[model samples]
Target: MRNAHRVEQVRAAEAELMARLPEGALMQRAAAGLAATCARLLTRRRGRVYGSRVVVLAGSGDNGGDALYAGAVLARRGARVSAVLLAPERAHAGGLAALRAAHGQVVLDQEVGLADFSRADLVLDGIVGIGGRGGLRAEAVPYARAARRGTVVAVDVPSGVDADTGEVAGVALRADVTVCFGTYKPGLLIDPGAGYAGAVQLVGIGLDLPPADVSALQHPAVAELLPEPGAESDKYRRGVVGVAAGSATYPGAALLAVAGALHGGAGAVRYVGTAAEEVVRRFPETLVTEGGPAGAGRVQAWVVGPGGGEGARQALAEALASDVPVLVDADGLTELGRLGPGALAGRTAPTLLTPHTGEAARLLAGADGGAPPPADELAAARLATARRLAAAYRATVLLKGSTTVVADPGGAARVNPTGTSWLATAGSGDVLAGLAGSLLAAGLPVLDAASVAAYLHGLAGRHAASTPGAPVTALQVAAALPAVWRQVRASATADE
Candidate 1:
């Protein structure tokens, strides 16, 4: 698991660690790691660090101090280094003295900075740190835009990104790579901020932190969570997932949802909807029924919505009234807005809400009794959006997009880093809804089920779309699930 701590938590941890070490010891450790990373990148890009032209965009805080000290190290090694100070007067005194002693060129001219940024082998963006918000200052904006030729490395985070929420309010520096200190920040793992951050490298400074504010599950953790059938397990004992998706007009949604459910850990799938014939024709193993969820026999969990269309309201109500865990998606999510939190008032069982950006906006509007922000805005600030919805409904929310975020009412959140752009197909979300429902039926908690489902769904999408990925249909993603599941489980066991 990759843990992401908020800015305050990081500061507290750093302060505690700094107290135990000698003066300037922690900054030296950070600078050493930063310099080593720059050295490696320089060697890989230009074949050698010697004779390389490096420009450090030093700001007014520790971020600038780290970069200035790194510049001093690079200067001593025969690299031609220059420092462009956004706040020359407020720059770290120790770091500035060190760079000056090493003979690194320091200048205050923006034009010269731009020229160096354009020609240098590498540009270190230390103009802003995790605590910095909004966009780059006016003085640093041109330098960020001028780095068109060389690799731009950001220290801690890309300037302008909200470290805790992954929101980019204004113009932000885009980095080819971001070397983060201590641990991963939420902004590095979530979108908008994640999009600006091309690739991330973590440098440990030995700060003991608390439980993560956000986390991501890798293969081993997912493998342990996946339900495995025992010797005494039967089809019923394994799990039964009830799916109420599709209508007469859109039978493909039912086929796709059933496809995902069958491939998921559930032993059997009982589908009840208007698209019974279409589902039965494609998946003979599915126990099909034309009746509503009330008469759908026994099921460990229910997946409502998808292509429910006009029938969404009734199906969602039935599922919500049931004692079992229920996953609401697509049209069902739209209908859910009508009842607000009142619908889920006394329900004892867990309810999982899967909504894309648009649906999430509606959910927010319904709960808050006001117009919600646009889907693009919600997507840019994925963590906050998901957390808000989770808190509003008092249920688990799986916000699906470039970076899938699963947030529970209790404040625990997980970011899934497995998906590719190829997953933006028509019925892809339906597939995810069914897969997550299957995990819910298999006895996993709502948060775990949603996160693991997203992890597997993303991997399967990648497999369906070839190397580097290509366009693929939703059914292909569903078909790829078994192979991916086996690979994940096998990889986990091999590590043991």
Candidate 2:
């Protein structure tokens, strides 16, 4: 797991480092890494280092100090360095002095102006860091917005992005690459901010931080959660997943669900829905049941309501009552409020509720339930939303969106790191639900199953989209699962 400490936690860690280190040590370390990254990016773009124009958007905090120090390095390397101070009066004095000592030019924002921005080879966004709140203040906004496709590097978190919640309260500077110091912030992992973060490179400052107050899982965490097919394990021993989804109105939902479940390592898939014929036509392997989920013999888990038909309430209630775990999605989620808190509160079997924001808002705003909190910006509000749902419905809540957040009953959450915008196509959510249901059948806990499934689904979507205009159809995403599994399952050392 990659620890994404909250802003307060990062401050405490910085304080700890400051107490032990000599003056100027931490700043120098940060600046050195920043300068080195800029040099590489310059070399990659222009092929020559000396003549490049480097602009620093300086702020009042140590963040601007970091830029000034880095500017001094670039100046020493023969790259022309200029500083445009957003907070001219309060800019880090020591850093300004050092840059001047290294032959760096200081220019007011109005003096150099936005026209100079186009000619600049690179821009170092030192306008804000973890200490920043809201967007770039009134002055910094225009320059940040003008820097399109420029090789922009954020000092820590991007200027204007909320480090704690991944919320973009105001216009944010989008970074081509972000060189993070000490530790990763939650914003760098969650969406809106995550998307703005671009590619991230961590520069160790030797801060011995404890476990994150919040965190996001990387590849290794995904590997640990994946089930390995054993030599002694038969098909039956692996798991059998039952999917009760799709209706005459939405046959595509059933097909996508079956497609995803097939690649989820399920030994078999049993279908119980109005779309039975569609499942049989798409996949001969799916065993169609004439009755309902309970009449489908034995199943380790049930995936309910991709696109439910008539009398979905009774079928869903029956699935919930089964001794096995239950995954509720789509229509099932909308009606979950009817389970009325009492049913969920009393249920013994583990339950997973997958609801998007619109569904969540309705479910959360019960008449006796109180007004719903403002919908979170994205996954930033996900942890809070999931916690609320888990507490209210008494089930593990997987809030699906740009960044899928899987929160356990205890409020511990994992923000998915692998999802893509290309997954916005139709029937993708059904495929995701089926994939998660299969993991539950294979004996993983709700949080693990939902998170791992999301990771796989995202990777598969990316892999499929590699084909031009491929669009990553639901079947394409499912087919790419084996490749995703292989890439993650490679038994390489961490260094590799």
> What does the lDDT read for residue 2 in candidate 1?
88
**Local distance difference test, each candidate:** 0.92, 0.83
Error of 2 at 447 (Å): 1.7
Superposed model 1: Cα runs more than 4 Å off = none
Residue 82, candidate 1: how far off, in angstroms?
0.6
Q: Which RMSD values do the candidates have, in order?
A: 1.1, 2.5
lDDT (10s digit) by residue, model 2, range 1-496: 7778788887888889999999989999999999999999999999977988888888998999999999999998998888888889999998999899889889885546565665688888899988788887888878866745458888998898888877788899888888889888878877778888988888888887877756676788888888767888866778889998888788888899888888887678888988888799989988889778878888888998888766467668889879888998888876776555665655677999888877777678751476654565434566667777877777888888888877777767788888677888888888998999988888888888988998899999999898553566777888888899888877423536
Model 2 misplaced regions, further than 4 Å: 109-113, 147-149, 367-383, 491-496
lDDT of 1 at 311: 94
- Cα shift from native, residue 145, model 2 (Å): 2.7
Estimated TM-score per prediction? Answer: 0.98, 0.92
Residue 440 lDDT in model 2?
89
Model 1 weakest lDDT span, ten residues long:
139-148
Per-prediction backbone clash count: 0, 0
